[model samples]
Every structure is written in structure tokens, then in C-alpha cells.
Target: MSEHPIPDAPQRRTPGDEFVQALARGLEVITSFDAEHATMTLSDVSKRTGLSRATCRRLLLTLVELGYVRTDGKAFTLTPQVLKLGTAYLAGLGLPQVAHPHLEKLSAALGESTSCAVLDGTDIVYVARCSTRRLMTVGITVGTRFPAHATSMGRVLLAAERDLALPETLPALTAHTVTDPDVLRAELVQVREQGYAVVTQELELGLRSIAVPVRTSDGKIPAAINVSLPMNSPLDPLDRLDQVQATARAIAEDLDHLH
Candidate 1:
């Protein structure tokens, strides 16, 4: 599956909206950069952020002055200082630490890549990952974000509780991508009822993944774990999927204890 940056938060009626609009725009500018787009020109940032070139340039220069980004006159790349934003988040979240070992063990047992991800707005961010080998062009790593509707982990997280606020149109990553919102909602409903999700060739051809929710002791689902492979399989491949479920349960137990 392809990776995407976290989308902007939806606008809402606020008591002091004007005071935070600039801050929100600045955050949007920073989030626009991702693994695929490390360096971007003013025009590139403008197009990606849908902001005017003047506004984008102002924001970029401000960030550069703040040492969050560096520029070679025409192109801009994030500096090491940018990591603080993500690191601050990971440092606060103990999910990665609790789940990392279990993910590694699961990957070793299954001989496949395993990851634990949580829903962050419209995307699922991989907080913990144990990769065996490259299954897709996009390598598995911590902080990788995938479209929620097209991934097993995403579906599991979406189906955990509450209705997902889907986009107006789902972007088609592959021929089998389910662009229909209704169909995806149906899939999410099934995933919620089934307690797991298996996605085949939806995000990429030949890539299949099975995911189960990682629940806390109080029955709160904060994340999902997945075992991904290259070959396609039947709809209900529960035998091989047992390992993933067991890993998830153990990780959930550890998370509960941590809390």
C-alpha cells in the first residue's frame, strides 16, 4: 500500500477560530512532507497543501528559520529538528515499546512482516513494525501511514467502534480498490462483527493482510496488529491467522498491564 501524511483536522465552529487558523496552516505545511516527498519546492508545497505559493513560501521560510527545515535556495528538506515532533508523540505513547517484542516474535514465527498500527484521523500510522522482507514497494517501518479504507489494519481500527468519517471519494490505489463508500462501510461493519479483517489485493496486487484488534482490558480498542504477505489466499484463512490473533491478544494484555 502507498503511504500518505496525516490529513488536516476537520473544521469546526470554534470560539476563537481566527487565533488558531495560522497555527493550523503551519501544521498542515509540516505534515505535507513525507517519505515519498522529502524535498519540495515552494510550488510543490503549494500544490500539495492547496495553499497559495506566497503563503506556502512564508510558512516554509518560517520553518527554515526555526530550524525545522533547510533550503538549498530552490528546494527545501526537513532538518533533524523535525523528528522532535514525531518523537515527542512516540515518547508519550508506550504502545510501540509494549508491542515491539511481540511483533518481532510474530514476524519470526510467521516468516512475514508484522506491524501494529493505530488510527490517526483518516490514516493508520504504524507505531511498531517487524519486517521480514519487502512485500511491497513501500517498506514497512514505524511512522508509516496507509489509507485506512484500503488496509486490513485500517479496517480493523475503523471497525473497532464509532462510524468512520470517510472521504467523499476513495482514491483507487489498484484495480481492485473499493472506491465505493457504501461498500467500504459494509466491509467495516462485517469486520466489527467478525472481530478481524482480511484484505486481498485491495491496496496492491498480490499483497494480502490479516488484522485483528488489540484491545485493552476494559474492552477499548486502541490499535490493531497485522501479518502481511505477498500471495493471495481464501477469504477465511483462519488457520495461519491464528498466530496474528495470539500475538495481538498478548500485546493487548501487555498494554493493559502497562496502563
Candidate 2:
């Protein structure tokens, strides 16, 4: 891949000596590695985290020594050990526990894959999923992430944002993917107006998905629920929206109290 500039770092606020910036920076370094950037150079890591080369190198080395990062002396990548962090959060929240049965039920009823996801920056991370059968070359899992701009769940979550912003450049994942930021903004507008999002082959050819918001009692959309199918599937997204929306609302209702 060509060199790319990383997004700006979040504003740092110094609270007190008890606030360990080093620890925070170390975690940020861990987050710099993802599916799209499974491996990165020291400079890439530095650029992504907005940390100095020396700082980034130190953190990476520390993580390496701690078995959280691995390097072949050229490019560095995170180890599976990093999954423990996300697992800890998942275990604490019990999201899968609350969402798995609902997803399974939906999948059975619709004969497709159903997933619960939450937005993570510009990506949507699957938190729970159930599939009636294999539907794609790559299977969906709890930690799977897809670009928000090209996915139904992502658009649904994005539309729920108070004021959505699109960068001038959007990655084109497929020929059908929306690359123009302006066009994508218009699509998001339509999604909000329609109270749902339907994506057709934007991420992959023959894949279609529809998503709806899972709102809390406070009306905040912390997550979304989606059902995915092949373009040639017998059922259309709208045909199953009734059950999907009801399941999402039920999950949100339970989450409001559980959380």
C-alpha cells in the first residue's frame, strides 16, 4: 500500500499525576493495528498514533517484550494476545450473552446471517452473529469489522450520529462501493429519512444487507442490528425488516436495564 497520513490524535487532557499518559499511549499503539492494517512499519505506527518515532518505537518494543506485538524486523503486527483486551470488555458487557439468542432466532427465521454491531470509529465491529449457513467467502465473527461507509449496519449507525462528516476520500472496497463522499452523504440522508439502510454489493459482489438502529431508552443508538444475504436470495431485506426491527428493539430494551 502507498503511504497514507493517519488521522489526528485525540486531544490530550492532563488531569493529574495519577493519569498515566504512558499507559494510555501504549494502548493507543495497540489500537493502531487492525484488519486493514494488520501489519505496519514503525513509521506507519508512528503516523497512525501521532506519537514520535522514539515514543512509538518504545511502545512497540514494550508490547513486543510483553508478547502483545510481533515484528519480523521490518513490519510489526499485533499478536492474538491483543484480543484479550477486547474479550475482557465483551465479557464484562455480556453483549454476546444478551444478543446471541436473538441473532440465532433471527437467522433461523430469515435463513440468513444476523448480526449485532457497534460503531468503532469509521468501522462497525460485529459483537454477535448467527448464520443459518455459510454465506460468504469470509465468515462473520464476533470481532469482524467492516468499513462503515460500505455497509448497511454502518450507514444505519452513521445516520444516527448527530452531525455526520465525511472525509474527501473514501476507500473503494468494490466497484459498486460509493467512493464519492458527497454521494455517500446523500445516501446517509436517505437512510435517516427511511429509518433503515439497505446496501447492495458495496462491500462484496452478491452481498446485500439491511440494518436498523438499536436505540436505548435515552434514544441513543449505541449499536445496530443487521441481516445479510446474497443478492439472489429468495427473501428481500424489506421482507424481514419487521422481525429484525422487533428483535433489535427487544435487545435494546434489555440492554437499557442490563447496562
Candidate 3:
């Protein structure tokens, strides 16, 4: 679950009283804590968030008083209370309510695992998943994140972006991962043309997945869904592409009807 911070999206508003810099800085402090840096010292937080020690300390103290952060007199870690924020956001979107049934149906149909994720900067964060069994070393949960360049869902989501961004260097999760920028771009082109993406043992050994974008009625791809299985599985992922894509469309249609 090691991941980079979710990069801030470009905002139209300029800095002003309307835009609360302190609130933004407070959120930055919260986001600085991730799986890789679950617990950090004052200096670590300041360095990670690019906030001064004085500001970091003040914010940390405030978060502590608010029960969103806990410190053992040295290292600070986020409290479970912080999860309420993410939970509130998911509830607001009603995505789990809309997508979970479809994921379960797809998983049952394919006798495999199904998941839905949204692009968050350089990673894809799983927001809903239905697992048949453990297929990888790390557990796949609602909050699990994987590198965008080496995942089927990530590729499908990235394909939908008009301006795809990639780091100067891509991390090779496994021997089969496509790290070369030129080659990865070629594969993205194929994914765009074919309307799906198949990643073979790129994220981990013996793991393969196929993903398709979940497009709303207005043709906006807000998320991507995928079916994951071991490399030794008897079923061909391509053969099940139609089923998975149909499930994705169903989920999208149901989501659109909500509005």
C-alpha cells in the first residue's frame, strides 16, 4: 500500500480570504500521513508537507485536540477518527451502494475477484471490491492502492484521460511490468482502441487483471472496474471481457439513474 500523496487538482480560484490557507494547510498535514509514513515526527511532517515547524506543530496540536491525530509524545499517527472523513465522502457519492451489488454479481459470474477504483494522482485507489479468495501477497481492500502504470484498472483510467501524466521514471513492480515510457504509451493506445486493458503479472507475480472504464450516461469515465485472477487460472481474461464490460456498464447506468 505504499503510495505517493494524492496530488492537488488545479484550482481556478486564487489565494484570497475566500480560500482558507490554514484549512488547506491543515488538510495537507493530514494527507501527509500515508501507509509509508503512517507515523512521523514533527520534522518529518514539516518536511513532507513543506510547512514550517511552527505551522506544523500548531496544526498537529489542533488535530490532536480534535481527536484526528494521536501522538505518543514523539511520533504522531492518524487516529481512526480521520477515517470518518473518507467514509463521509464515499457515503456522499453513494458509489459503494451503487457499485457493490454489481461487483458481487460479476465476481460470482466469473468465479473471481472484482474491484473498482478511481485514479488518484499516480495511483489507483480501490473504492469497492468483491474478493473470492486471496490471490496476492497483500490483501486487497477498499482503500488499497497500486501504481497506475502497472495495473489494468490504472491503464484503463489513464487511457480515458486526454492528457496522461507519468513520472520521468516508472517503478517496475515485477519483471513483466512495462517501465519504458514509450512502450507504456503504445500499450495505452492499444487499450484505448480496444476499450479494455489487460495487465499480465505486472503488479505482482502470478497476478493478472483486465479492466474497462465505467462510463456514465454523459460518457464521462469517473472510475474503472477490473477482474483479477491468478496467471494459472483456466479462464481466459479476454473471453470474460464482455461480461466484465457489461457489468461495468450496468454499474454506470445504475449510478447515472441515481442523479
Candidate 4:
């Protein structure tokens, strides 16, 4: 008998090999500084990303050279120039011009807050929001981010993200947040099966919301629409859920037509 050799499997692409991947990591380093960690030493960045201090310093220097970051004697912080990167992405999306008015209409009709969100890693970012009043406490605004496992918009977006790799155990963000990965996976499954997601007081106390996918004519979900209400609001959850789902579907249909 002749000897045979086994076939080799294809090698996977590493983060370092992809074009623009390094730029993304650098941008992440810039974004890692926020109000709480507005100014951080090189050691702080190393601790946050678990990268070596040398690596963090190199990236930080690159970012500073690009005008996306500024540094003092011992600490570094993001500069306003960093907004341009995010602004360029938002400009390319072209969603705000089309969806902002619809969000406003939804909020006006329902007397609640409405928003459009897209997935960002393990979080959902509000790209557009319409506030009905000034009484809410979540302090949500455009560019705000919230954990996907704890919000209706996050679950709806996750459900639409069939390619996303979900873990077996989820990290908790709050007391009511779902920590069991299985439960979150089940919730995502339910969202897909039901075509919408309803979350109550998971991200914060008295915060309730419902979300539905915003799909294109080709049935590709690029974002999600959601209505946020207070837990103690007199409005019934089922009623709000129906309204939000219907409005979101209508918006999706309108977008499909435009596309």
C-alpha cells in the first residue's frame, strides 16, 4: 500500500495581518480614555489592555503623532481630533439624515424616548436618539454606549448578528444584568424567533425598552430601533412593545424602499 499524507487546513488571519487592523487598535487605545480615565499614564494603558508597557507607549506615541492624542509630562489623553475619525464613520453611514426624523416622529407619537443603535463589540452605541422629555435618568445621548446583554436594543442587534460569537458565560454589568451566558444566548434566540426584544430594568433600575431590527430590502440588518420607557410609567409594556415593533418595522420597510 502507498503512504498517504493528510491535507493541511487553512491558516486563520491574525489581528496583526489585516490591513487597517493596526489603525483600529490605535483608535481603540485613543478611545480607552474617557471621563473617568481621562488622563492615564503608560502603565495605566498597559493594565487596561494587558499589553506590555512598551507596546502601550509605542501605540500612544503613534496616536500622539497623529494628533489623536495629547500628553503631559507623565499622562496622556485623547484630543478633539479623535472625533474626526468617528465623525467620518458617521458621515459615511448616511443613516442620521434619513432616520432622525422618523425617530423624532416615533418619540412624539409615543411620548417616550426613541433611538437607533448599532452593535459595537459587546456593546450597543446610540447613533441617533429622540428625547420626548427631560425626565429620564439613564443620561443617554448620541454616542452613548451600553452593554448588549443588558438592553433590548443590544439583544435585537445581537440576534441579527448571526456571525457574532457569544460566550458560555456573560459578564455582569449591573445587579439585574444577566450573567449566565446560556440565558443571554437563549434570550438572543428568542429575539430572533420573535423578531423583537423586550428588556426591563436590566441595565438600570426603572429602565425599560423594546427593540426591533432595522433591515434593508435584502433582509440585512444594519441597525436596530428602540423605544425607552421608565419602569414605573403608566403605559403597559405589551402595548409599548407592539407599538415599537410596528414602528420599527415600518421604518425598516421605508428604508428598504429607499434603498
lDDT, candidates in the order shown: 0.84, 0.85, 0.88, 0.76
Off by over 4 Å in 3: 1-21, 40-55
Order of all candidates by TM-score, from best down to worst? 1, 3, 4, 2
Query: Tens digits of per-residue lDDT for model 1 on 174-250?
Result: 89888898999999999999889988888788898899999888999989998888774343446667788888899
Better of 3 and 4 by lDDT: 3
lDDT of 3 by residue, 1-259 (tens): 2343444332334788689888988988998887768899999898887778899999999999999999998999999999898899788877777899999999999899999999988789899999999988777788788889899999998888879877777888889989998898889899999999999998988999999999999989989999999989999999999999899999999989988
Which 10-residue window of candidate 2 scores lowest in summed lDDT? 1-10
lDDT of 2 by residue, 103-199 (tens): 8888887788899998988888889988877766666778887789988999999888867777888998779999898898889889989889999
Tens digit per residue, CA lDDT, model 4, 1-259: 1011111222224655446856655755765665557799998877765556887898999888988888885999888887787888887786766678888888998888899998888788888999876544445677777778888889998888777787777756557878887778888999999888888877777777888888777878878988888877887756777667666677777776666
Rank order (by lDDT, best first): 3, 2, 1, 4
In TM-score terms, candidate 3 sits at 0.84
**Better model by TM-score: candidate 3 vs candidate 4:** 3
lDDT for 62 (candidate 1): 95
TM-score of each candidate?
Answer: 0.89, 0.77, 0.84, 0.79
Error of 1 at 131 (Å): 0.9
Runs of candidate 1 exceeding 4 Å displacement: 5-18, 232-237
